[model samples]
Target: MSAPYVLVLYYSRHGATRSMAQQIARGIEQAGIEARVRTVPPVSTQCEATLPAVPNEGDIYCTEADLKDCAGLALGSPTRFGNMASALKHFVDSTSGLWMSGALIGKPASVFSSTSSLHGGQETTLLSMMLPLMHHGMVIAGIPYSETALLNTQTGGTPYGATHVAGSDSNRPLDEHETTLCQAQGRHLGQLALKLQD
Candidate 1:
């Protein structure tokens, strides 16, 4: 069989969520698994149109194949009124085929998010993402209390998933707690995936 990989999928308009994806990928790799980072294009209100096959910059667009083949998943997005952005949601909505086929059943999945404010619905956004993954029969994972960062975070860490307070300017870098929580979530998901594979 091919090597195992954790799919780190996300959508970022202001770069904050993208940065979190990178950190999560780092932790995934640290757990001795490959990290495949991918992103989805934004949806336009204009008449039906599709994005180019390949993105011009940043991570490549995600394919259903990537989702099906991944051993684990780390999904991220920028919060939009306590929910995931439409772009990421659109991508997930297309995965009904995977759900129908039970292709993702039993895989470990985690979530992360970025918000413009400290309480900009980070937890709600994370939970919203988890709902679809759970429907696909994926096992949800989250940062546990053992991850010290969860207890120390004054900004974004939560029992639901990793998160970041990007502030209204979207310029505040992730604080130490946020970084540690992201890494912890990645490591937890990676380790669980490895265990499941065995």
Candidate 2:
């Protein structure tokens, strides 16, 4: 049988959310399971005319089978007016078939997000992402106060999930606290996934 893996699925327009996805993947792998990183193409065009089947670069697009087979999921996106980007939400909406099949039922899932400003709706974005997963019957995971970084982060990091403040130009890389929270959140979800499997 293939090894169990966590799906780190994200939509990143400016690379900040992608970097958070990588950090989360590293933490998932630390739990001795595989991490599969995937991204959804933008929804600017119709389904038939959107991105090519294969991306020109970066992570490959996620398939239904990938989402169906994951033991855990880490969803990331940039904040879009107090919610996840429409592109990511559009992709999530496509997984109705999986939901009907109960493909994600009981799976451990978490969310992360990036924002251009400190108060740019990071928590609301993360919360919005969870609504779909909850409907899928996935067990939601979040960082607890024990993480310490969550306690001290003046920029981003919420019990809702890990988040980043990418600054006005969207150029600010994740600060130390945000990075730590991302990894810690991933580790928490990874451990939960393994435990649920048993």
Candidate 3:
């Protein structure tokens, strides 16, 4: 068998969500598993138009094979009216083949998000991301209360998943609580993946 890896998949317009994905990946690696960071291309409205096979910047584009082979997943996206971004959603919606085959069943999964405002649907976006994974039969994981950050965070940290308040300008870096929760969520999913592997 190949080494276990947690796929950190995300889409970010201004880089906040992408930063969170990096932190989560750091935590996943800290838990003694590999972290494969990937991103989906933005969708265009022009009929039949498509993005290039590889993104021009940041992480490489995620492949169906990456999703199929991952032992765990950390999905992230910027909130779009209390939902995941259209680009990430578009990519995930294309995974029905895996869902039909039950290829992702029993894998561990978690979610994260970043929003422009404090109440801009962070939790809802996280939950929205989880719905399809649940349909794929993946076990959902979230940040537990044991992570002190959940209690201390005034910006963003929820039991549903890790989140960040990027503020109206989308320039605010993750606060301490956001960082800790991201790491904790990543570690939580990684540990669960290990246990599930055994």
1-198 in candidate 3: lDDT tens per residue?
Answer: 889899999999999999999999999988989999999888787542355767778999999999999999999999999999999999999999999999999999999999999899988898989999999999999999999989999998899999999999999999898999999999898888888985
Which consecutive 10 residues in model 3 have the weakest lDDT in total? 46-55
What ordering of candidates by lDDT runs from best to worst?
3, 1, 2
The digit string of per-residue lDDT tens for model 1 on 1-198 reads 899999999999989999999999999988989999999988887532455767788999999999999999999999999999999999999999999999999999999999999879998999999999999999999888998888888999899999999998998899999999888888888888899995
Give candidate 3's whole-model lDDT.
Answer: 0.93
Candidate 1 vs. true structure, TM-score: 0.96
Query: How do the candidates rank by TM-score, highest first?
Result: 2, 1, 3
TM-score, each model?
A: 0.96, 0.97, 0.96
Q: At residue 193, what lDDT does model 1 achieve?
A: 85
Off by over 4 Å in 1: 45-50
Better model by lDDT: candidate 2 vs candidate 3: 3
Instruction: Give me candidate 2's TM-score against the actual structure.
Output: 0.97
Worst 10 residues of 2 by lDDT: 44-53
